[model samples]
Target: MAQLSDDCFAFGGDLMPVHAALDLLRSRVAPVTAAETVPLADALGRVLAEDVVAPFDVPPHDNSAVDGYAVFFDDLQADGETVLPVTGRVAAGHLLGREGRRGEAVRIFTGAPMPAGFDTVLMQEDCRPIKDANDGDSVAIPAGIKRGANRRKAGEDVTRGSVVLATGRRLRPEDVGLAASLGRKELSVRRPLRAAVFSTGDEVREPGQELPQGCIYDANRFALIAALRQLGCAVTDLGILPDRLEAITEALERAAAEHDVLITSGGMSTGEEDHVKAAVEALGALHFWRLAIKPGRPVALGQVRDAVFVGLPGNPVAVMVTFLRIARPILLRLMGAEESEPRLFPVKAAFAYKKKAGRREYVRARLARGEDGALTAVKHPRDGAGVLSSLVESDGLVELPEDLSRLEPGMTVEFLPLSEVR
Candidate 1:
């Protein structure tokens, strides 16, 4: 398992701003996972461990960009059509056997290498072909065609000895294709982060089990496990731990020994039955970071020995939001990914909202297209933090910044799509 070098991410403030918390995380966290080599077929979504350099030019030779006739540009007539004999033919893979003289034309197809001494191409549609008794085959070239118009120069896409992909970048499908184009079979990448997820609270029960009057099915654990898996983490489900100090402590100790990070939901607040805080404090360091954000105000971060620990809120919606916005970045950094923020798009608001000026808020909303083909964000009817169904009904969240106190309709606001993070 990967481990932290030191435990230095503790904030003493009662409430911290969202940006300040993210900035602190970026400065304090470092990648803990080791590097490994994997084939190109299995490289997608993995963080690159080293830079990839191009060995040679992308298209090793100058080639024709279209099916046409190749010839010397100076041979064409300046005033009218010029007829030249079609002395040779070339296709995608085949090349002309020998160099040609100035007055000769070669029938060439797209991606065919340009023959020696040839500097121009005329499209087949613009040139007329003729057959005669004296001349075997010839094409009538238009005088106004530009010189070198249909030729593709070598190294136009990529140059030799240039860095094509940098370290700490998460490989995408196009990145893999580029590596294949460079004739690379495998890539060096960071190993996936090992994570263990569980839920606490005596009122929580498994989905298939019978629930008592005050008990509810465990949704946070399953949700967290799925989210962690989506982020390419090797997630182990520790099940639901009862709200007992000793039981929680023992389970956490065993899990911390095997995993890089331990994630738990609920039992983070200062309540009588919340034994998670006490248990984590006994086994490791627990720092409660009271964020000024709604729904996920109570979050804990610390370490057990060498493994990192994260305690999130109990509500399902808060669990998803906090995980996506906060814990996701931290885990990504530990997995060797760059500290980058998710892209937020601007869209017109279709609802009015009032919020505290100093706290950041994310409102669940869906987009609707007007008759003019403009997208407008429509806020969800339900606003409760426990309303998990609202997240399902909406497409993403309308991010209200700390300075904004009121949101009116038709105003442009930054929107964070769930697809961007999840």
Candidate 2:
């Protein structure tokens, strides 16, 4: 059984800055368990736990890049076309037995290993064959051809003993192909982080249930679970917990005991029915931080035993925002993943908006390129946190800086791509 301390629950002073809180959270987390094995086909998206070094050159030998004649460049007639005797034919996977003799050319096809003493290849389309004393025995080579042209040299792509992939690289399809090219049958990768997800609040009902006058179905849990899966986490859906201290506490205890991290939405704010904070405090520690961000002002971060706890807002948009802004970094750290800064691009604002300083705001916006070829962002009609339909119609989020009070049309603002958010 795991245990938690209440040391973080004593929030007696002003809330800490988001960056500062994140630093503290990251410093306290330990790396997850890791293992290594051969998973050539199923290794995509797994984080590399060790560096991969190449044992051999990518191209084992110099090979022909085209179907042509292999020749010694020095023997070519510089003034005009030079005719040479065709020594032998070399195709892919078959090499000429002996080195090329002076004034003799080897007839080679694409991917044929370059014979010794041969330095250049003339494409079959670039040369005209001439008849010799013995038909099919000799051919004429063209002049003005450079040395080493159309020849793929060995060790060009990857050299032996070179570091092909560093630790913490997430293996993608291309990475897997590269590893296969290097003859790697196995890879060492960090274990996927196990996350237990649940939702709270008496007013929240599971989908397919009849909704009461003031109740709504739980959507955050499913959304978060899908997002977690996309992030390569092994997620366990713990379902919904009522707004009762005992029930919430029991769920937290069970989750902490079985999972690497526990995540819950709603019931962390100051409402009378909010029991998530109390349950976290009773289990271990709870740190409720007022994020200087619109829509998602209340966010919680703490730990229960060895399992990390993240509390997201009940509002749909707030849940999405807080998870991307805060939870993503911590989860990646726990998984021993490399840190990649979110890609932000500049887009011209198409509408004017008013906001206060000292609070970050992410507005759902649709992007379009104007007739003049300038990219522009237009705000969604509804800015409410519950308008999830807006997100479905938007391309990405327009980031309003913490110091900006108003945004005017044609002003350049940073845009966070939705691809990066999930």
- Tens-place lDDT per residue, model 2, 247-315, is 999989988988998988898777789988888888788664566676686688888877889999889
What TM-score would every model get versus the actual structure? 0.91, 0.89
Tell me, what's the RMSD of every candidate? 6.5, 6.2
Residue 214 of candidate 1: its Cα lDDT?
A: 98
lDDT of 1 by residue, 1-422 (tens): 86654412222355788887788777767899999999999999899999999999988888999999999999999899999999999999997988868899999999999998899989999999989898699999988988888999889878999999999998889999999999999999999999999999999999999989999999899989988988889999999998888899999999999999999999887778888888888888865466777768777777887788888988999888888888998898889886457899999999999987877889999999966789999999998888999999999999899899999999999999999986
**Hey, what RMSD does candidate 2 come out at?**
6.2
**lDDT of model 1 at residue 409?**
94
Can you tell me which runs of candidate 2 are displaced by over 4 Å? 1-17, 77-79, 131-133, 137-145
